[model samples]
Target chain A: MSPSDFLIIPFDDWVNFLVRDWLVPNFRPIFRAMQVPISMVLKGLDDFFAFVPMVVTTLVFALLAFKYAGRGMVIFTILGFAFIDMIGLWPETMTTLSMILTSVLFCTIIGVPVGILAARSDLTWKIARPVLDIMQTIPSFVYLVPIVMLFGVGMAPGIIATIIFALSPIIRLTNLGIRNVRTDLIEASTAFGSTPMQMLFELQLPLAMRTILAGLNQTLMLALSMVVITALIGAGGLGLTVNTGLGRLDVGGATAGGVGIIILAIVLDRITQGLGEQKKVETTSLRQTLISLFKPGAPAPAHAGKAA
Target chain B: MTSKISVKNVFKIFGDKPGHALDMLKSGQSKNDIFEATGQTIGVQNAAFDVKEGQIFVVMGLSGSGKSTLVRMLNGLIRPTSGEILIDGDDIASCSPAKLREIRRQKIAMVFQHFALFPHRTIAENAAYGLKVKGVSSDERRERALLALEQVGLSSWADSLPADLSGGMQQRVGLARALATDPHVLLMDEPFGALDPLIRKEMQEELLVLQRTLKKTIVFITHDLNEALMLGDRIAIMKDGEIVQVGSAQDIVSQPANDYVAAFVADIDRGRVFTAATVAIEPSTLQLADDTAGDAVRTMEEENRSAVYVLDGEDIAGVVTYQQAAAADRDSGTSDVPIADVLITDFPTADRDTQLADLYAPASSGLPIAMTDADNRLIGVIEPEAVFAQLSADPATPDTEPQVEADQRELAPTA
Candidate 1:
């Protein structure tokens, strides 16, 4: 027939047989067990976001934005949440928020330690580099079927796929940040007799914090972008709304969902980016911020006043 | 003084398999040869020296000369590939990591060239870092950190962040961090190499002033020869990972070990490097009890000198010039006038250890500056001629005959 016909090896069939006959049957239980933690956390966050009154949630988020991102962010956050509420997408938005939060939480829990390990050992980095490359570069939909076969189609599995997609940046950046600490600073710490743990916590971690926060912001953005894709696997959120609207070819509904996602993304991005850029010395603890918020004559937070 | 830190035949070869490089090196191959053959860079080679207690032992070299690498080994920051590095007789090279860390925490501290104060940390926090590593209580560490900051004249900046301070002040924080531990020895690796010249000079003076009281056994690394001569009680000149010579400022200036060392010392200001003790000639004297103005005049004439010193027992009464002695001899109308009566007691004097540069004013009187001991006894005399001779001597000239003749003339004045 053709030259190409002679070279065909049915690699797709091999992968299919490997997943269906070997991996799914033997490792399904382990995969299910892995989903349990994600399910619990996702359920808890989803319930909390849903149960909280819209006004109170809005106020709390706005206060946080004000404290970290300044008054401009505060105004945007309040108006953005109000607009989402006006569109009757509050519940869906809550579910999406929970999904993004759960994914980020899990990615940080797994990614940061792996990143630290990679930074410490050349062998670990060599092994991780290629795996992270595959996780990041492969089309997000390619692994959807495997994730579905392993963990089944649901919110937790959708979030799991999202985690796989979003985990690379945090790990890569964390490794880079820790490795890039000034050698003289490292030497100074060592010369002062800092033990390995002390050096990590006192010198390395504190110094690498800004870089790590930037990584976190990147991870958050990736997680947000994955929402619509994850919705294909039965994830309920603004992503679901958009998917349903598109199915019926309702342009207005899809645009509303798109607007809501953009609003949420911008608020979250600005807050986290501001957090990354905030001067470490000038930043007050949350407890202090709360105290200052309620204290008389302390109308604005210390950082806000300084910024103005 | 007892040796506080002793480094003996230590070598540090950087590569995956240093043993091969070591074997090659032991076979008498040069560092360049070993590197070319095996791809291993020799950081320090066969380095051996003792840093006596309270002495500033400066290891001076140009960049890539391994002076930094050698200083790092003293604090166990870089372990030697072979041989022993002993701090108070304990072999740090062979010690366990835990023991090495313990020794570093209690016995030694280091100041970096870049003033490696943590950017996120406050001045106090950076200063307290050493004590924090040692598990000191928070309040106590803060108190001690403040005290150390006070030593560096940065007590008021304790609460300020490191970025808020100037470069010199940041280095002071680095010094304060080192001093907070109050360790027995301080290792400074080109600590002022990054500062501006004016700030470097100020920091050097401040460190010397601090060393006077702290008396911490210091091993200072610098590429600047003037810095080495100004601050070092003894200097070790390193070249290509090996110490070319180790001696006091006077010794290294007057007698460089090899051509490389001579070239290195050639550009140094010899007027400041050579002290009065180094250039001083033995004094020509007339005894206060037995010798008279006529004896002074006869001695000056016989020696072809401008002046003679009058000694009352062991201590100098003053100097008697040729004109003064002859004038006294003529005015008295007799040869028995006491030498003290003609002695110019108001003549300028200097300590034997005073630098030749500092002896200029005393030498300007056109009389030999009487070099005295601690107890005011006349140990020697610094003639203007000898000062100029030593200052102007070309270090590149292989012929040392003029120096030898000058050395002989110093002895001949007293003979």
Candidate 2:
């Protein structure tokens, strides 16, 4: 082994001491203390806002459908939701979904800013890049060990594993997007007296968004793959069910859970992909229709409507 | 349009602490002294010129003349290390961010040779992007974008992606994008340098048409002599990061500012460049207007004419009748008949101080137009093919030899 690998041994030992010895024993008490009051606040809304699930889910699917393939998709998404309930898997499906949601949410919060920062600063990007490379290249199975030690083999462990696997795409794409902005366009923006901040938010970021969305798509896919792997650490969801059934050699149960994960993956993938595709098409077509619509005798192709 | 851009005593040096280098240079240090003191290379050296508004001002030179860098500074893309760029009496360095944005988004627009239309967007989308970014209402932006496309004659290609367009068409799209911003000034950096010959001509005409209609202030950069001549109202010839000369097209063509400018204009076929205004006309000495045909021939031998302007009083008429000249021989006791349909190239058709080398005897007369002075007097008559004859001597044109002595002038200059 190289000297670098030798140093990694003590680093692993330190991680074990902190996570396995200190965190597992004490972290839950600290987390529970924080959650108790928030749970009470949520308990008050739980009864009155039981329909919150239906409304939020509908809005999300509806907006996604409208943006992507259209209302045809919305009808199908609604039916998909109904099937989970009819199969008596509503609560379990929701639990699996929340886990996926938490993973993606945390990934975006951590990943996007890191991506943006890397895009702007060369030194920061150079430092952040190799770390992300390591995160992506390390075995997903290996990630479960540290998270299990720290977060103690539950949904949080599943979440942490998913985050590490999914975070790389966002940062890489964000860097590429910013770098690829046209020299003339950047100069034009600067000439306009756009402050450095204004240029970042208004010009550079918007232009980079399409690339960033592609990264997000990649991240979501990686997170979905890692979710099932994390189930071996005792996270209870479709993944945990699949893992449990496999342990007991229950083919019917395992197959059903596997099928359920596929269904969820397809739906989420389609909706997010649809939104990304729509944004790309919208920005692009707006520039093009300017000339196309003006063509004398070339009958306009429905220019009055939204690009979708 | 007025004086919109003035670059005064500008110097750009590439190195650490260019300010210190400039200060040292200003404090009696030579170029080599500065080089030794600061290890700096000068990008622009004491470049001073003003671009008049609504003029197609050309800055032309070989690579490293800093024309590209100069244009960048004009548009505030780069700040000068020393000296000032004044736009409408406002120094660019003094301008605020808001002011700069106002200038970039409103007053000026730029086109690049690479046709850097956004790869992701369609032609129309790329054209309308500036307007969209500037917060023009969608309807107005779309309307203006369409108008710009129509002006560039690319309305039919609105939906096409930039990648799909031909290089010439993509340059047009780049032009359309610049036009969409409704700019007061247009900055083009060799925008047609990459096209094939035929397409380059087409784009040159396209730009001429745009300038005619828009009357926008234009700053164009190019290294091609022919293109510089075809486009610039006033040209600044650059060499080694400094302008060698700045003058009108006529001045540059006729007098030439220096040996460099002379070398730049050399090898250009002057016969084609000169029009009928270059030639002279003398009244016909042969007075036998209506004499018998045999008598006209006798007068022709007596009064030798290169190209007799067969006149019908003060107003011009036609060439001498062959039969009249043939018959003049009998009246003059001469037996020879004059050749019919001889080309009238030497008469009033040639420019004053017309170099003897460019003159050629008429091979034929098909197309004819009169040259006039500022006073509207007929100087000479020239046919369309005369210019062609001079230019077609190109050894590259294997099919045409061009017998005129003028045709060989280009080869001798190089020799």
Candidate 3:
């Protein structure tokens, strides 16, 4: 036994064997089952983006940005999309946008309820808190390995990795936001005879909307960053553009992809943040006011409808 | 009638092992002793009282004295570690969730010290919240909310956000919120405690005036004894989670149950609290304006007094001194002359609720202060000495028999 061999343990081999045989084989069926919903959402988003011309999509986003973030964002979004198209990354940009949106859509659908559960029950919070910590603390790249082994190398696997990477922030913040809703308000609501569901919808969620939106923003940003990284394992999009540009040493193309990603990141971040800001204003939107008239029992759906 | 709200042997021990803490408390451990031994806080201890219908029943104590806790229990906001809270004959402590919600909606409503108005909502919306929870139609609830806001003089500001209002206005919104529910009972946990002195006084007056017409059972919590004295029809004083005493304002003020209660009541301004009504006594003798001056003098002599009130039936005409009656009699040269001409109307008159502080000028003018009813009928009279005696802090003094003994005796049986 040489010096190097003398200190060695079979930890790596054990982990490798666990993943290759037991873990992968046992969880393959579960992963395969997960593919159904994932593909459905992915395909829906892909086709939706494909049907809308790049110009139309840019204008729609610009209109949304104008509603939420104001004039500066509108201009930025319009110019940014036109630049991405001029650089011939329009198709790839759409794929990336679809992937990021799908990832966030799934994250929001899953994260919020789980966050609500965590906020409600201390036992659920106790179990969830550490799992979220582990998911967040593990390097983003580490998620790709199990994702690749289980789902194989492709856009779906990349998306699964992005979903996992982006999942923690929304859950953690939703839990925090709900928990942070003033105890006095909750007590007042309860004292006034709000049912638990009523309390959550009427008192807790409305009060917690801003914080939860902040969480969505964080989750969206994480998904975008992860999507770029996920391009490594044959996932197509802007990440592929950058990775290919890097391989061919074409700085200009890579820089263009980087600029597109940056613009998307800033635009999304600003829009989500602005949605939270709009909630702070005393005025309710005309649509919300109408919704309120129609759905009297529902909580104010201004933020919830948008996030969902 | 059944009590509007009744708390029976209620104890709230705050900790994981309240049941165990309660057992220890029942087995003779003091609150502090229990806390030291078991790390459990006794939020309320063996508290029992009945708030009558249409009464403002105040629970008063310093901070951390469980006054808030005791009031919270009325609406089942804080469940007692053991014992029962009955609201209009339904024991809320044992109520199921659905039943509790029904009781909270239809029977008892609460107002918080911090206002607890939702910042995102308009004041009208906050006021209508209870009604909304009760499944009232939007139009009806909004109407009721506006009506309640009108009661609190806040209807005009209903559309404004709660944060835009002053502290006092916000509390009015809280009060209006509670009022809109039209519940049988209102639980106010230091609802006006956060207001400034001037605003607090105004709110107290407003609440009293509102109570006159609304007639809802109110359980108010406050640390300010002056507020308790001013607002409470009956007040219960709590200390260290235990109710030390419970009685009317006069009873608690004049005959404190113990030194702790005495100390609490000591700083209270008695002149403002003890009204002309509380201090007034029956006149020793009376004379009619139509009576002969001879008869008036004779009655005055018999009563060993200088003056007599000239009564025109239940109505008070004036006060006449012996000299005035005799002089009128001599001048007219007849005992048959009516005493009405000799009657003097120079003394001060006040309504029954007039503060003793206001009565001082007239009371010290060497004439007894004449107290009148709404119809200007003489109810009773308050002398400078009587006012002094009633205002005195020493309860053991013999001269203040009517002031001290009457209230104590009335309360003794119930206490």
Identify the candidate with maximal TM-score.
1
What does fnat come to for each candidate? 0.69, 0.29, 0.62
List the pairs of residues colliding in candidate 3. none
**Candidate 2: tens digits of C-alpha lDDT, residues B1-415:** 3578887888878888798888876676666678887898667777777777788889888888888888887777877788888877878755775677678787888888788777666778778877876878978987889899999888877877776678888888889888898887788989989888999998998899879889888899998878887788777778766777676543455556556667777766555344333333344323224433344444545554323444434444444544445445456564533332221223334444343235443324433444444454454655445545543443222112212122112211110
Model 2 misplaced stretches (Cα beyond 4 Å): A1-94, A134-161, A184-210, A229-234, A242-308, B14-42, B119-125, B155-165, B250-264, B272-415
Candidate 3 chain B weakest lDDT stretch, 10 residues:
B406-415
Per-model CA lDDT versus the true structure: 0.88, 0.69, 0.85
Q: Give me the iRMSD of candidate 2, please.
A: 7.1
Ranking by TM-score: 1, 3, 2
Docking class of 3: acceptable
Residue-by-residue lDDT tens digits, candidate 1, B20-77: 9999998899988998999999999898888889999899999999998898888887
lDDT of 1 by residue, A34-69 (tens): 999999999999999989999999999898898779
What are the chain A TM-scores of the candidates, in order?
0.91, 0.75, 0.88
Q: How many Å off is the CA of B88 in candidate 3?
A: 1.4
- Output the number of the lDDT-best candidate: 1
lDDT-better candidate, 2 vs 3? 3
Off by over 4 Å in 1: A1-7, A280-308, B282-291, B299-304, B312-315, B398-415
